[model samples]
Target: MVSSAAQTPSSSVEQARQEGALQTALALNRLLNPFKIEVKVLGSTAHLRGEVENEVERQLAERVALATRGIETVQNDLKVNAELIEQPLERRAYAQRLEDATLASIIRARLLWSTHTQAASIEVDSREGVVTLRGQVSSAEAKELAGVLASSTEGVYLVNNLISLSAADMARLREEHQELIADPPLSDAWINDKVQTSFLYSRNLDGPNIKVATQDGVVRLSGEVVSSEQKTIAVEVARQIRGVRGVDADMLKVATKVSG
Candidate 1:
């Protein structure tokens, strides 16, 4: 009879390495060719590390990792390298491109949660403008909203959605999200809400000047935190909120006016 005990991680790790090199090779191909990035795959996780020309390349790397067979998740450590730009003007242009991508993602996320729309349940995470979506929605319509919102964002490089829904539902959700983007709402109260809450509750950060505002579910945290660790904690707090889809931490920084 087979034993009920769980296999040790070490044993599992060895098993994966011994299984075949095909998995590793395929992973490399996907990262280098289509995504144009270097990847290191071990067991079920893929580490995407290296410098990319812009945010788009950074996100493409993550998507390729997810598509590769047997990959459970991707650890994205891709950096945006302006130095890769051959010309000085090109480097500035690349920075602008990344900035646009980030801002777009923020706007889209805010629009998504601005109303009591059918997509109230989704969660969005935007980092340097790339959107990573997570959480459960009651229907496919909600899932599509998650994607559409991410896509519509100005600075968005890619949308990484981990939503669960039936095939039929997924189609409906996508359509709805698209419609909202095409005719976005004037006010984004929901997005502001998500941003505010993230800073207020994040354990990874603390600060005195911290001010949080949320519209719909996106949060904007502005203020002063003494240390980088505090800033991180503030962001984490926003992430924990249920309906939050995005967080803007630009306002968080070390206070210069205060005396030590």
Candidate 2:
């Protein structure tokens, strides 16, 4: 029920993905300023039309689009106000650290504005080019999203996410974790069968030693592997399979028989 490459969008599958990409970009924007914008979707490409204050904001839009899972290319049609104040990158090499600090501030400001993040509790640090995020977040997804935001910021070269849940949140997380492990929705026997077959077909793995299970959309890989490398590969295979929302590899162990 899909069209060929040369065909029109007889189906809106690609269109939907493009729309999703646009929504992600808008969410990331947080609209700190009054600069109006428009988004257009063309196949796997994201077209951005807007006016921003400076080059940083201009590039921020492209970065957000590129970070989106479905967007392959971003066309930034953003106009920056020529009179706007911006850190002149053409300054001497000594100003490099200052630029990094500005990028960090931009990241922190965005985090504070995002509805999905707890920016006040999180500590942001930028040294040279790397940004380190510390403090507590509500969940694993929030932690990951924070890292994504930091890394996608214009000047960040590296990210160290040290955020964890608070004690109260941890308690709540445990209850959710228990339910998640106990039940998996949108998952069924077919996905389980596919996961097992994927391992069996993998040239690098021994599927017989790895047991695969699926619930809802979560995939669990248990049993044992001959080496740590094989264990990692097995987990990755399960993660790549369709219908898998999360992966549980807690029970997977590397065999003692294998030498380090």
Give the TM-score of each candidate.
Answer: 0.28, 0.33
How far residue 258's Cα lies from its native spot in candidate 1, in Å, is 13
For residues 1-260, what per-residue lDDT tens digits would candidate 2 score against the true structure?
22346546553666776676566556444331334557776666778886677787888888877877777898889898755434333332334555556667766765653334523367888887688998776678778877766775555689999988887876665665466446544446867886786576455778888998888868888998889898887776676554567789999988887458
Candidate 1 local lDDT, residue 41: 56
Per-residue lDDT of 204 in model 2: 71
The CA lDDT at 12 in model 2 is 64
Model 2 poorest ten-residue lDDT run:
85-94
Per-residue lDDT tens digits of candidate 1, residues 1-260? 11225557775665355333433443333223322345555656777766776787678767766766677778889888767665345444454555555454454445443332345445556665566777655565556755654564434568788877566655665676667557644345644455453333223444336887766656777878877766776675455444566778897666655568
lDDT of each: 0.57, 0.68
